[model samples]
Target: MTSHRRPSSPRLGLAALACGAGLALGGCHAERIVADSYPTTVAQRHPIVLAEGSTRLDLPVGAGAQGLTSRQKEDVRAFAADWRKNGRGPIGMMAPAGAFGATAVRSALASAGVPATQIVSQRYTPAGPEEIGLVKLGYVKLKAQVSHACGLWPDDLGSGGGDLYGATENREYWNFGCANQQNLAAQVADPEDIARPRAEAPIYAARRQTIIEKHREGGDTTTGYRQADAVVSDVAKE
Candidate 1:
């Protein structure tokens, strides 16, 4: 995580920080220099944030449909696909009472790999007449999530407030760049990737054998990149 910088304001006739001295203000704004120099809390620099948490796929239960609507059915199917790939453990079903489209949910669940014999059920209450109910498919898979709302200002910036002493010192006030961390966490599609690298893909034996055979027949091993699909990067090799 990186700290965001606010624009630096001149000291207004005060000493202008030296051009390149270690003690001088860097290219960072004036507030950044102070915030970096003296922070009131560790959270200002390195905050502990949740990388993963419990999340649910909420599917709307429509009323009088007597089952999932076409859109809802497609949604269930999509959830099923994801669950099969990344779900951590057993899938639990949360069914509202008299839920519509019970059969469709069951069918979709079965299609996704849940056995009919092992299907679990629960009672739920419907919120409206047009609504049949909702079926929840949950698994405690390797999900990475973040805490809700962090990096709030620790000290008040008002004049004559209890934290007035904070102003005299070059200390970073609370609530700096908390939203940036939260935003970064939200961009993570898989929390596991944040903590560790992904697993390597399996080799294609058939393709490897073909290449080996071609090499044995005195063919050129080097192949040109596909111009249409090639991805070029300038990153230095480790």
Candidate 2:
């Protein structure tokens, strides 16, 4: 003989309903409960600087490449000229020696509005003495001092990311969710999920503000200025 248990009574159903209602109410309360509050304007307190005199830009070259093509060189020169005309100061660029050499950068600076006299190129040999080893060595360095009095470099420096200036400006670095959130903040966008708020929002806002302030104060160190170009490049690709 087979015996079966009876179904749960209406009382049980009523209890479940009550529990669900309590949970929903609790959630609403939680959302309304404002936790410890701090100043909201911390992020906004920082100012942004857009241009400055004479900045260094770095470009990386792939291995085994020759040099920048004539057209590419022209493009760089034009960019430099524009930056100069716009009060960006002196514009300099660096790249690997082989194909994307200093000549290409010089051309770009010329195109960008810089006169040929203002363009300067140098070769950077690797630091260590493993000269004949398997490691490749040969890099082209370019430097331009911005002729105008502007703060573009400092502002760009503090913004973080690998910029054209080749500086690592991101201070509150993180992984996974936080990293994503910080990246979003860099773009000044609303983040999409909870992890971002919990892990990234506060720090990113603080860092951004700091960078802005530094720019405003005329912070000239390349500490934050170096990676602007690269960051811009990656963002463009994305």
Candidate 3:
């Protein structure tokens, strides 16, 4: 009657146990998650144009009103000249919209060896809701997508998308206002008014790279770029 019970089931090693558990969990496999990012470097460069400062121009701030002093007029002319020479064509007029437009203009003038002067303040009514809405949509649709395409996620603080609603709204508002100014300037005078001395003024395209780079360094560059790129790529893919 020396019957020994069958040896207890062999104990599984940690590895074997893990494998069994994994199998039991429906054999899930790790899949690469793409947040659809954009190029941070390019996005950042877009706003760099403002870093240069304001350029003094010799032009009058008003139309035959003579509101500006002689010195002020000279400063305006100097700035206008430099803007015509080095600024990005008609687009340069949009400088007032950007954060560093004044600074960049000053820097450009100085670089061109022009003297500096005080700038006259020209205030206008705020943008209407329709304009504001369009701008907001542009940011939400374009810039935000760009950020996300660069492999960025709203949750990632490094991506700078944490407060995307606010940032995008602000950017859109500013850009819209700037664009509106350009439109008004264009309408105020003939083509000559916005004309530049140089045949080839700078273009916004050059700043594209700068925008992307700055954004990359400032946040989750990889994610933002990836997300943005993916979004665009998908549209193209479709």
Candidate 4:
């Protein structure tokens, strides 16, 4: 008996090609998903976190000292000014039991425009003889800071590690841009400025009026300044 070979099915060949193409596309898609799992942007990796925090000041008082000295009073005043600007709750003043500087702290805080109701006094037992006259002042306030701590190296920078392929991908390392984020957080004056925009400041009425008057009279709207030697010396000419 003579046997004939079965002809190859065109449909089976097309189906094999289709499955191979599908596998290739699926591999690329899986790689994209894996790459996106890590934070790509600096802000995403090290975000500026707004949270509640406290500010503290420590003042050392001698056993024989009377009230706060002039310098201490100034320091307390500056601290209170900062509290008034950003602090939320009462300003707390803590001292060793039987310490003599509580009255002085209250007086300085009052002089700095802090109301008596806004100041809270507490006393603590001294840890040692050296802490007898130490007075501490603190208040709760809103703070802006980086979420991640600086100086952390989670990955290797060399070519012989697990991150060797990652280095070739031209992406930022884990700790890149952390210092810039930290500095930016430290420079933020108001945490609210990061969350929302401030209200517009009042316009300079006098300057606006002057400019409008000059425009109405067909005069130069641009400001002219009369320079004087007393105001600005012409160092180049001299």
Each model's Cα RMSD: 15.7, 23.5, 25.3, 5.6
**Model 1 lDDT tens row, 77-195:** 77767766666656667777665656667887787677775556676776776564566766565644334356455555764463544666755555665666666666767766766
lDDT of 3 by residue, 174-226 (tens): 12233334344334323333333336777788567777887978853343433
Where does model 3 exceed 4 Å of error? 1-68, 87-153, 156-238
Q: What TM-score fits each model?
A: 0.52, 0.27, 0.20, 0.75
TM-score, prediction 1: 0.52
Best by lDDT: 4
Shift of residue 17 alpha carbon in model 1, Å: 34
lDDT of 4 by residue, 1-238 (tens): 9999998799988967877887887731322334433687999999898989999998886455569988999899899999989998998888777767777888888989999999888888776776557788999999888886987877777644746546667777888899998898889999888778899999999999999999999999997799865534566556
User: Taking the tens digit of each residue's C-alpha lDDT, what string does model 2 give over 1-238?
Assistant: 9999999999999968877887887732323233333223322222222222343334443434346666656545555544543432333343333434455455545555567665444445544443311112121222222223222232343455424223332232111133333343445322222123445445588667878888999995345445544677788899
- Model 4 spans with C-alpha error above 4 angstroms: 1-34, 62-64, 164-169, 225-238
Name the 10 consecutive residues with the lowest summed lDDT in model 1. Answer: 28-37
lDDT of 1 at 109: 75
**All models: lDDT?**
0.61, 0.42, 0.38, 0.82
Which should have the higher lDDT, number 3 or number 4? Answer: 4
How many pairs of residues collide in model 3? 86
How many clashing pairs in candidate 4? 0
Pairs that collide, model 4: none
